[model samples]
Target: MVAVVTALVLLVFIASFRFYARFLGRRIFADEEPGFVTPAHELEDGRDFVPTKRPVLFGHHFTSIAGAAPIIGPCVAAYWGWLPALVWVVLGTVFMGAVHDYGALVVSVREKGRSIADVAAKVVSGRVRLMFLCFIMVLSWLVLAVFAMAIAGLFMAVPTSVLPVNIAIVVALVIGWLLYVKKLPPLLPSLVALVVLYVFVWVGTKVPLDLADTGLDKDQVNLTWILALFAYSAVASLLPVWLLLQPRDYVNSHQLVVGLGLLFLGIFVAHPSFDAPAVRMSGDDAPSMFPFLFVTIACGAISGFHGLVASGTTSKQLDKLEDARMIGYGSMLGEGALALASTMAAVAGIGLVGFCALPGQGPVEDLSWAVYYDNWAHASGNKAAAFVLGGGAFLQQLGISAVLAQTLMAVLVISFASTTLDTATRIERFIIAEIGDALKVKALQNPYVATMIAVLPAIVLATMRVADGDGGVREAAWALWPVFGASNQMIASLTLLVLALYFWQRRRPVLPLVIPMVFVMGVTMFSLVLHLLAFWAEENWLLLGLTVVLSSLILWMSAESLGLFVRLLRERRAAREA
Candidate 1:
């Protein structure tokens, strides 16, 4: 019965998203007109703007946006109970995330494939454009920093994932060469690559690699992986889209689909019941769910980061305007599905391990549910570990050995996260170059120079250590995640504001976009204010300053947008009177 409920819920969410997609296509986007030339064709250079087929583009977009966030956020947020997390993931994706992504894609498509920041310049003002650009650069920096640390942590914790991850990169390069250099058909080559990658996953299980076994201290091992990741990002950022970014994501997308299928099948066979509480408060230490929940589960529900991917990279590669609906909105639903799976795993798998109590909360017998989640939340650097253990437990039901199942789960996460890391570096490079153009700085305009500038700060932040409550030091990435979530959600609010302005200018209805914009703005600002108070109390000056900057920028943009809305309304009324 429990398994049946889970399956039904997932199916219903998917079916509803499909219907919403159709509605959006007809009423909002108004369908792609014939003879419309996409930027992929008009600006095709066999590089960033190369025309891509639907499946390949969807794969790239989905994998790029579907990083560890969806998995990690839901895993951690399950502390409030899986029921609330599941609700947010389902509704947020259908209404908020998909709308933001699809709108950004269509608006960018119409604007010659410019980013939402660029569109803000035309629709709002040049000053707004600059502010948005700055906001995005900071957001991207955090993304790169956090994801790099995440992949490094995963590799260190699950060493078997290391070999498969590196091997997948080699496979991607080979696949890139075959598809682009040799002019082979992509379908057959991508399929063959997928098969070979899975074979490698099996090989990885047989011989897991551990960095700690080499006699290095924990910090030293982490530093080694961090440096290795940044070095790879530098090279990957400079490579053409056809070479590394697109092909690698395409392969990772296949792995994600296969992994999800097995997880769901395992759930059915295992019939894992809900183990966590339906709704439980974490006392005064934890923030209430109101704004925190919305921001914590950003990617699964709605994320501003997807707007950057949609406009910054994906729009440039869209072969057809019509495809944006699927690539934009459909990909979000795919991520939501992943989040749901993670939530289910966290709730079910945590119980099997016999440590289900909320952190600092004593165990309670005779509770309705079998597991406690707050305990997992308090386990530093173990959020990802929890998800892996939970997911592995599910896979175990499929007759896989516990060791092999955990390794497979680790490979799935590391591959997804690594795809996000390099892609973010590339996106950050683009933003840096655009900032150069905005500021008229020649040196910064060079992609290589801009990439190095972006990478340096990320590397430093990723490697830097800060003192934790236990008097032990932890990587700065752990400290920055809360701020990252707030900043990320702010970006979503700003993107929605941009979309609202775009729709208003065309005399279209803006209610569909405006409601989510206002709601996200309110929730994110509330959360940021709370974070600001907390950071001040702790004397974390670095994060405190960042919070101030982001808050100020968001407020400034909001004021400017209000002014624009008023002006646009007056002009429309005047034109009607005339």
Candidate 2:
């Protein structure tokens, strides 16, 4: 609809403003003191620190932030009432998401590209850093496990999916080898590999998965696969970037950009109306609106996880101080755009003439209607009517079936889930190594040993839970949402604290620090409480126990922070301490 066109334009404008404010407006600071060149600035090399073009960084950042969360959250949250989900996504991204992401990257760059945990150590103490690291490790484990199962589930769903993914991985490996080992031109090989991968996807659908009389339990087998997958992830991450990480990201980034463009084009041409009811129909089974909704949709609006990506991977690569704004702010806006695309997809099925009004459920419930009980835009007449309304304009122009277009949309959702699994696994392995090294356990420090130690628990938990008929790993995935949200927020809180530290040392304005710091802390703690309660209610005593342990660590650190803040404030009052 033209209505959606206006929304898209507005988002682009807001995103552009955020990018400019972050980078180009570096001269227009609220206040400034001495020019402080942090380690990242001092250690700049063109390899990592080369100034990235905004468009290139846009692709990089967008692919980094864009993942299953945006897709899955929108699809599920749409069941709530698209309006709330829509509002939260659009408004929340502009204010909270962009601010959190952009600020984190900028702050990390200022601190010489130290990770959030490292920053916390400097701002707080070595003990706090250790605690933060441990918290992150545990959370990373959950993220890896959840995504592992998710990717496997996607593979199982399509039956033929294995072929496409396998081919893509192989193509990536070939490209990696040629580029790194043989010193081949990266761009050409990457392009050729991607084309090969796409052809394989089409061919893959032709091959059968032998589903008939298959004896394996999908859930049980999936859990086992997740464990085995982590073992591989451990090995992969421990190796140099030329081996796996950089190559995959490079190929995946191109794929992501191309795929996203195609999907957007399909949507533009299809002109699907919002068919689902704007309101979500609720039942007694639904959890309390407050906690459930907040947890269900963590990454789309604002994720603490974004802080980790910003501070850990991206910050270290900043070529210039100004690049922080473009890479940070602009990337987040891309994520918001993806969220908006999902929201619009959900809304597309609404309000079609001659569409026999059926009760709309699933993703459409949230945006178009206020209450769950209202009339919804059903898919039947909705698609047909849009086709008629467009008078063959869009279809004739795009030359794509609306239904095939929808399938492509779904594929993108699954791809995000798959890519996230790979990324999450790599990160978790690093966390495991860090924890193991800290504990000074030789066996634990061994990559294989640590990976097995980390993966087994999740596999058993996923399997046993599934065997017990609780939807297995799928249900356990729910338990993970809050923990992921909190851990990410905790990272954000730490990042902001670093910014505050830099300002404090430089004798600059402290109000900016106070605002974000307070809000993130509140949201983080609230999320932690909700997660703990959910674990206890589910009678997941093991996780419940782990939650208690982690909470104790986080609370102790938080209390320590408060004490430090108070002492600092008092010290400032006593003497204008910079």
TM-scores for candidates 1 onward, in order: 0.95, 0.78
| Candidate 1 backbone overlaps, count | 5
Per-residue C-alpha lDDT of model 1 across residues 1-578, encoded as one tens digit per residue: 55876787788767866797778777777656788899989999877788888988999999999998998888778878877888888878888898899999998988888989989999889999899999999888888888888888778767777777899899999988997899888888888888998888788877878888999998889889988999998899889898999899988898889998888888899887778778867555667878788888888889999999999889999999989988998898888888888888877765555432232244544222233444434632356655787788789889997777888898888877888888888888888888888999989989889989889999888988876545676667668788889889889988998888888777677788889888988988999999999888877777788889988998999899888988888988999999
Worst 10 residues of 2 by lDDT: 380-389
Per-residue lDDT of model 2, residues 363-439, tens digit only: 34233322222322232112112222222122233665433332333345555655555555545554566566666
User: Which model scores highest in TM-score?
Assistant: 1
Evaluate candidate 1 by giving its C-alpha RMSD to the native, one decimal: 2.8
Candidate 1: list runs displaced more than 4 Å: 354-381, 467-473, 574-578
lDDT of each: 0.83, 0.57
The TM-score of candidate 1 is 0.95
